[model samples]
Target: MVMCKDVVENIIGYIDAELDDKTLEELEKHLDECPECQVFVRTYRKMLELTGKLRERTFVTPEIRERLKQLLKSKLKPN
Candidate 1:
């Protein structure tokens, strides 16, 4: 059984398909029994899909770029 904390720590790698076979199986088992994690995984997958769709387009609008910059700046600001 996987702890929720470990699942939280590794969820991104699991979504990226970087986990090994055994670890993947363990995570999958956890996901099956964990409704909260299941919701998180589904939302995360949707975010990835939307980002990928944006990437497939040849251009990003200036507004999008500015918003992304602001988001990055907010993240990078010192606490």
Candidate 2:
């Protein structure tokens, strides 16, 4: 079963459409039932779009991506 954390961990790949077929299918199914995740995904997409229009483009390496995932997971965690 795909959990919220799974969504967060895989979000980068999900947005890039780089996930394997099975993972993508599972993530989409979870997204369909989870309003919070849907909102998160939309907001993330908008952030990416805004950033993309900037003069300097940030190249995200695997290390940076891992850090981003940790940052996002921290933000999403309940107090």
Candidate 3:
């Protein structure tokens, strides 16, 4: 059975349609049963979509910058 961490690790490939048939099958099975992973994958895809559409000269408010910084820090923190 695929774990949540496995889902997280492979999500980018899954979204890009780069995963192989066997791995993609496993991921689909996991996603079907895992609501948390489903949410995570959805959010990751949305982030990819937003970033791909981002303007080169976009403005970031100070508060938004700070929040993004915190989010990055938390994600990078060791569990």
CA lDDT for candidate 1: 0.86
Candidate 1: segments with Cα more than 4 A from true spot: 56-79
State which candidate has the highest TM-score: 2
lDDT (0 to 1) per candidate:
0.86, 0.94, 0.89
lDDT of 3 by residue, 41-70 (tens): 889888887898866656998999999999
Where does model 2 exceed 4 Å of error?
56-79
Deviation (Å) of 67 in candidate 2: 38
The positional error of residue 26 in candidate 3, measured at the CA in angstroms, is 0.7
Which pairs in model 3 have colliding backbones?
none
Clashing pairs in 1: none
Winner of 2 and 3 under TM-score: 2
Q: Distance from true position, residue 7, model 1, in Å? A: 2.2
lDDT of 1 by residue, 2-67 (tens): 976767889888977999999989888988998998888888789888988986785879999999
